[model samples]
Target: MPTLASTNAVEIDGLGKRFGATVALENVSLAIPPGELFGFIGPDGAGKTTLFRILVTLILPDQGRATVLGRDVTTDVWDLRRRVGYMPGRFSLYPDLSVEENLRFFASVFGASVEEHYDLIAPIYEQLAPFKDRPAGALSGGMKQKLALCCALVHRPEILFLDEPTTGVDAVSRREFWELLDRLKASGLTIVVSTPYMDEANRCGRVALIQRGRILAIDTPTRIAESFGRPLFAVRAGKRYPLLLAVREYANAGTVFPFGDALHYTDRRDGLMPDAIASGLRDYLRGRGFADVEVKLTAPTIEDSFMARMGEPERAA
Candidate 1:
């Protein structure tokens, strides 16, 4: 394992990969500290999965190298596998096997019995105990995810790689999963989780933003959000298209994106106050034949931060 002060728990330097003409990851480099819950945040095609695969030794990198717990991912494949627990984006548990059987199977594969590592998986397993006899294929989405997580942890790994562990799970399940992760991290587990959920980025000790097979920014969530240096406004109306047009046509509009409830707007206006901007937006929407128009100054959120950082040139903040 990497020494405490000398090496990171996970390190990737000058990493690059390609699939024919498509570049999957490019010059990606990062150093994750011991016991840190690091997140790779991006969209579906943003190369999050590719990076995870390389780090866990599932795929080989073409240009650079990486080390996990001081073991090279490429050269020390077998050793790395024993040290890391990987829960891929999809559930890959045996469909015919029951939950308990699945857990026992994974434990035995590592030369350890279920009783030997029960403490490591007990928290997640408790939620799955009721369905222990149910076929893995018949379990609910959340239960299946929990089972997969438990199976990965059965051998007591030094690092856990969760690739969108909450992707298809219910809202309650997602909350519970994160809570369980917190408990495990409190016990000194190093976790690397990749997700398309920007909201989950803040829960991580640090986050790296990837897009189009390249890294955009990596920092604490607060630092990433604080980097946005513009006044923001949320503009809304009965119809979004015309409201968007009006906001875009507004002279002071700097950036505009469709946020969940409204269009988040930013501007380069120096002296234009929030009230003045709000007035201009309402008047323009009214002129465009939209009613019940509302506009308000709002703070930047993680989603807003992602849009501001990665959206197209015209919409960039």
Candidate 2:
């Protein structure tokens, strides 16, 4: 086992990777502090998983360097593996094994016993106790996730990496899972969670928005939202499809994206007041055969920030 040498849990510099002709990651760099809840926010195929795989030492980077717990991910892989916990995007527990069996298996891999590390995972394991005897395959999606989390923490690692932990779980389960992570962070555990859901970004202490193998921005969710430097509005009308097209075609449109039940829009005329923008949007939509159209000033969200950032061209390679 390697001794901790610094407060930074993970560090990466100019990291890049590729699979044949397909680029997976490019010029990526980031540093996660010990005990911080850091989030990698991006949509599917955004290279979030590729980054986690490299950081956890499961794969090699084509360029640059990465360190976890002060140990190089490539050169010090053996020692690094012992100090971090990883729950991949998919549920990877042995299907034939009972929940208890899976937990025991992971613990044994680290030369530890479940009973010895039970306290470390108790908060999450307690909810799974009743299903201890059930085969992992028989459990619900949420239960399977919990079992994976317990298995990941059985050895009490210094840093944890969860790749889209709440992807397929229900809304309630997602909420509960984040609550569990919050508890873990409160106990001084460093966590790096990647999620395609923008809403989850707000739950993280800091977030990095990634797209097409590049990092768009890295900052707190609040700061990311605040960085949207323009007034925004939620616009809706009778038909969303036509409304979306009309909004995009408007001469003064800055950015128009579909945002669940409404279109999130901003005006190119940043100097205009919110009320003026709203009034202008209504007139534009109504002129384009939209009826009962409504446009109201709205606050920016992490999703808004992501859309705005992604609209820009990819940085020079």
Candidate 3:
């Protein structure tokens, strides 16, 4: 049996799982160092939740091995459970319970007290203190997430696993939640978070892009975007739909996809200067009667890299 490395807070090798005909994870492998803010970036059904559940000891993997904090997920589950804090994707606390009740309940589960770990959750608890008397279900989305986070942290676990902690919250709330995560990371906590939002990748120290039960790439956000390694341009015109179609129909078009309010275009020909490619594309659109066409060279984003990788053939395990 392979032993978990001492340096890794979490480790998985050839981890896999399935639900009858549905494959949740396939040949997944990765290592997370302690105190790192690691992120699993993917859309829904990409196996992020499954991977998290296994690490948190909620479920067993069908094959391969995984360990959290040097404890085997399958063998040392009882000890691991007490050492890790997990905030599931869904709100699992009693909706009828008041905010304070929920926090106290979770603390007691691990044989701890809210007063014992009060310092750990003080920052987040202060916000929820005002709503301590309100039913958990009655709080706004942001407050509910904060309360859930408090419950998860009340036990003072060595590592934290949050499954899409910011999903379904308002944009302002999302930003605030990330700020809280940043503070936790600075406090030397190893946090493993999964989210479908590509923009959030920037906040992670390192991220793994998972799709269809496999990892496409894993690196720092900037490096992952830089790996898109092809001349790319963002083109916009009066009509986005027509512009997308026209760009896709271009003979030299390598990849064309609608991004935000513009179309991100890549060319088939390599080694061509970006300015030349942009000029040629502008002329082509002008000739096609899109008089107000604007095509400019733009840097690739993490989403662009994910989209590009999604089109390639999957690697062999």
Backbone clashes in each candidate structure, one number apiece? 0, 0, 0
Q: All candidates' lDDT scores?
A: 0.86, 0.92, 0.93
The lDDT of model 1 is 0.86
Estimate TM-scores for all models: 0.91, 0.94, 0.96
The regions of model 1 sitting more than 4 angstroms off are 1-6, 239-242, 268-275, 289-292, 312-317
Native-referenced Cα lDDT, model 3: 0.93
Better structure of 1 and 3 per TM-score: 3
Ranking of all predicted structures according to lDDT, beginning with the best and ending with the worst: 3, 2, 1
Better of 1 and 3 by lDDT: 3
TM-score of 1: 0.91
Residue 280, candidate 1: alpha-carbon lDDT: 77
Alpha carbon deviation, residue 143, candidate 2 (Å): 0.5
lDDT score of residue 215 within candidate 3: 97
Give the least accurate 10-residue stretch of model 1, judged by summed lDDT: 308-317
Residue 87 of model 2 has an lDDT of: 98
